[model samples]
Target: MTTIKNSPRNLAVTVLERINRQGAYSNLELNQVLKRHQLTVADKHLLTTLVYGTLQHQLSLEYWLQQFTRRKLDPWVKQLLLITLYQYHYLERVPAFAATNEAIEIAKWRGNAGIRKFVTGVLHAALKSGWPDFAAVSDPIQRISLTSSLPAWLVKQLAAEYDLATVAAIGQAINEPARLSIRVNRAKASLAQAQAQLAAEGVQTQPSHVAADGLIVQSGDLLGSQAFAQGIVTVQDESAMLAVESLAQVCDLSQATLVLDACSAPGGKTGQVAAALTKPASQVVALDIHDHKVKLIQKNMARLGLATRVSARQGDARQLAFLADGSLDAAVVDAPCSGLGLLRRKPEIRYQKTFRDSQRLHEIQLAILAAVAPKIKKGGIITYSTCTILKEENDQTVAAFLAAHPNFALEKTQTARALKADRAAKTLTILPSDYGSDGFFIATLKRVE
Candidate 1:
């Protein structure tokens, strides 16, 4: 087998090219490339910064590139220019000359003499011309779209639903990198025990203000550490942890209970629900749509020492004929969504998602809720959640479900520490700026009949 090049710039370019040309996800593609190559900590940081920065500011970069290039360029050439422009404008520590020289060198390695000259000319032209004036854009939505590097459609949708200032804040927040957080496995260890163990291994951490069991990883290779290997901790966003915590708060998990995680994969929230149960007699059933995802849930449960408490099954959540009606004590429908709230972690989603996609997801979300509604026993709780802030997938979906199923009503009393609940509507909407977590929405409903 041939070796893969791992230089910071080369890796960034390779990752960007794949994402741009092949429609690969930025995070997944970057992780795969990082695992294949040996990179120092600093190089790893640089690679991550380059890849994410280039993607985050892609629209703005192209706007600037237009000022210099009279004609369209090759896909690889455009990506390389974006990477260099990202460093030039955003990363102050990187000298301008270094950024320009690196691009020319990479061009020489990957292109012909004509391409090399083209690359050099573009960089020199960009340096001489300076940045584009986004303020000149007349349309408010268009201005925000170009300045924030978000899609114009997303900007318009957000503007329609929120004030201009709030939309601007949302756009700014999503561009920043997500904070790293880990949930302490209460089953295997206490928060103190996990923190001390991580400290002993030279990992710095601070308690998360939002999640009761979360700790912000200040500095460390959390995944590479023994704490992770031994399952003392699992990387999870505080907002997601809050969703499970909300379900646990409203439901009686103190006795023998059956909780179904209808769309669990990678098992983060399922593990949270299982670990939160105070009674050993209670069990959590985790289901996913694919065999690979079911295996992933099983693997995660095993790692966290929860294999005995959480059972993994492969099946579509929209069809639950295998389960008996009114059999479960509680259920969580963390429905699949457009993932608008997770843009900080998954920047590529902004470009890929459309208004029509959200409409389709709203239907799927309601279908999964309807399928699981009958599985919940009388007075049992069903938690509806998504890693998206769009009302179409959150509030409107719940409203539609309640309209169709009159026996179930929103549980109004459930509350979480960092989540803001609309008591009148009985739903919690957690914006990214709200508590420094992903944009998430949760609602607890009761089968009152």
Candidate 2:
């Protein structure tokens, strides 16, 4: 009685195939497909797990597929086997025979007899032979790459930055699911009040170690709860909150009148800055190149009750000719990068991004910093942040910007004690393995003319 059109497994196969072939974003694509199908909550969870799990372990699955068959596979067929293999190894509750039969049925429904036979042979062979041993991978990098399901190039990149042990730890941490964390709107409610409110709505949360205003969701539907609905809290990673928290500490926000959240969209950090600016006249301009994104920032600001203190506009961060020189007190540059830090939440990034991509982003990040540097008044601060943990995007970008602009000096980031930010280094890099949060790099720069 299983149908290809609506079955969770079948839908997962379709979604994964699209992601692989067309380079579709996993989260957005999965959400769109889920809306098209009328699935129960359990089925929806299954489909989501299948899509992410398959993508998370894609490299290992493809490597195992090579052992069973050397021939090239049609994209869908390969994706079907990959998800099936993922279920076999990771989903302990799903009976192996049940997963195999379902995969075979899907293959039969989608392909001809030859393809169906090929899929059946591969799945059966995999279940019988079991997964290959990581110990057999003689090279340490290869061993970690295969075992962790990270790309070999990425593994090498991390290994080069840190030791093999650290790379292994990061690889292991990224595969684990990211916990849902939200930043409480301090202007509207305190941490205890937010927790009590969320608890009243059946959502339990614990205080985050990374940021004072951040909370980690322990259970229940936070996004659907009244606390989130009323804008008392908004979904943001704990590491992300660290950027604004550090900015507030390193810079004197009280005496400041104007602040710029360059590259702001959906305005999480913009709202955070708005919350910090207590003065009625103090304003934060949130800028993004896309009009829709600017609208999104405005929408978020209204929801968070920060609209009065924020100005959402459409503009390029690289060109800030609108602002006069030395007119701003402080600025926050949350520059865009390869997003390697979000691999846990969006596993597709590992495959989609390249080394060249990070290098190119470094130039763009440096440009944004340079464009905003001359605009800040003497003794003002510019807090630069990126979601990526790459040196090229973080440390190197700062170094390049500092080299060109001698007036700006890197200032040590002051954050929560739990963060244990290195006092000697002026920048803070939070790896995914550090606290099971998204990887982020934050650096504060002081402009002393």
Q: For this target, which candidate reaches the highest TM-score against the unseen true structure?
A: 2
How would you encode candidate 1's per-residue C-alpha lDDT over 330-393 as one tens digit per residue? 8888999999999888888788889999999999999999999999999899989999988899
lDDT of each: 0.87, 0.90
With a 3 Å backbone cut-off (N, CA, C), the pairs that clash in candidate 1 are none
> Backbone clashes per model, in order?
0, 0
Pairs clashing in candidate 2?
none
- The TM-score of candidate 2 is 0.98
Please provide, for model 2 over 1-449, each residue's C-alpha lDDT reduced to its tens digit, 9 standing for 90 to 100: 43676899999999999998899999999999999988888999999999999999988888888899888878888889999999989999999998998888888888888888888888889989998887888999899988888888999999999889999999999999999999999889999999999999999999998889999999998889878877899999999999989988877676678999999998999999998887769999899999999999998888898899998899999999999999899999999899998889999989998899999999999989989998999999999999998899999999999999999988888886536654467799999999999999999999989
How many angstroms is residue 219 displaced in model 2 relative to the true structure, after the best TM-score fit?
1.1
Error of 1 at 318 (Å): 1.2
Worst 10 residues of 1 by lDDT: 413-422
